[model samples]
Target: MIEYVARSGPPEAMNCPAFICDTCRNQVVAEGIVTWATTIGRDGDRGPHQQTPVYVAHKGRCGRGLELWIEQHYPAADGWIDLWDDLEDFVCQLTHNLTNAFADDTEGTYHPHRLVHPKERR
Candidate 1:
């Protein structure tokens, strides 16, 4: 249901091999690419947090598709991060922890889209 697109700079240009997964006839329930960057804070910045942010997005397949995916995928108890932290850790977590979680059936199925608005009550 979920797949790894690629690892590269944002957008991956126009004709990159990463675009192979570009088309899905079944209609993507939800899909997005993860982009990471390292930025140096300005002199007046404030925080004890890391110097980067992780961003995850999901261009939902339809108006209600996103909600359906969340209901069927993500779980009630799982760690989450903001879209503004160094994505390195977030991507790594998804690649390893979340994927493993999916297999173990112990935690949520891990959806980049659900990460934004994790759950909704029926």
Candidate 2:
């Protein structure tokens, strides 16, 4: 997993669009897939600034094989640029949350597991 803030330049200089997860195909707004904030400057001299904090991973239930899918489909030759960090902070935090949730062992509470493939299920 990787986490970083992506900034887009002025309207004329804007190149890349917002990051979309390959697993979801931008169909749903899931966590760690597409997080952004738009700020309109009051000066009126510059266009609205968009800052997107992306958290990508390949092990999560929500988005597995996202990185590989993106790599194969959206190669850098087509103007796709890799702009994520090496640290898997998002995955680490997800694991930590799951560990804590399961450790609680609270009654009437549900702990969701990763999505399993139908063929892999026994």
Candidate 3:
């Protein structure tokens, strides 16, 4: 299982890459709250539903499209959970034509931590 921990920086001594936001096309730094998921999506226009994007984005304006996408597809759900988007080439698309996403603004809600390398946690 691919497990993930939400943190802004890599473990001590070494550096891990940061994910560039698909919406803003900017670096999702510490002050910015990010969310991602490896969810199911379409292949194309009316295409077969395939496991699609790792939704990496901030919780507000940059994530508007994803919010709408979820509401149209899964209305019963109360909110969305974000996931990693470390992939160099992200395939899935987030549509913004629908209504706005009432995403619970996640900024400043959680503490962003520095991931401790497993070996370094002695």
Candidate 4:
């Protein structure tokens, strides 16, 4: 689980409104398909309950909305540029990128998730 600290000097939790499907806006967990690449913690009161290698819970809008928000707010970040109509594609890309970053596979070889986008599926 990633912790957010406010610039004002208070410990705060990070919440991304885009992660949840706009319709539900309920809490849900996302998991990585690749075991070695990435891992996300489980949702619980204890904060990041499990160190599982495939699970991230988000609330707000779906991946597509989240991608749009990311592009608008964090333009420099090229991670979630392509929109995903299928949630499965979104999950796959999310896990792949997260796993690569978490593993610190900076060699640009091992993970190589750089330019790959959901559109490539087409």
Q: How well does each candidate superpose onto the true structure, as a TM-score?
A: 0.21, 0.22, 0.30, 0.23
lDDT of 3 by residue, 1-122 (tens): 12233455545444445656556666665434333332223232232222223445555676676545534443324222334442322322223313434354455232222332223322
Model 2 pairs whose backbones collide: none
User: In order, what lDDT does every prediction score?
Assistant: 0.33, 0.40, 0.40, 0.34
Candidate 4 backbone clash number: 8
Report residue 90 deviation for candidate 1 (angstroms): 1.8
Better of 3 and 4 by TM-score: 3
What's the lDDT for residue 61 in model 2?
Answer: 52
lDDT at 97 for candidate 1? 67
Cα displacement (Å) at residue 11, model 3? 19
Report the lDDT tens digits of candidate 1 across residue range 1-122. Answer: 23344456776634322211122323232245333222123254342322212223334343234333333433223222112322244457666864565657655542222113223322
lDDT of 2 at 83: 42
- For candidate 4, lDDT tens digit of each residue in 81-106? 22223445655776788756645765
Residues 1-122, candidate 2: write the lDDT tens digits: 23233557775544444334535544232345422222223245254332223534323654445544444444445333334432345447667887576557666444232332224323
Predicted model with the maximum TM-score: 3
Weakest 10 consecutive residues of candidate 2 by summed lDDT: 34-43
Is 3 or 4 the stronger prediction by lDDT?
A: 3
Prediction 1 global C-alpha lDDT: 0.33
Deviation in Å, model 2, residue 118 alpha carbon: 27
lDDT of 2: 0.40
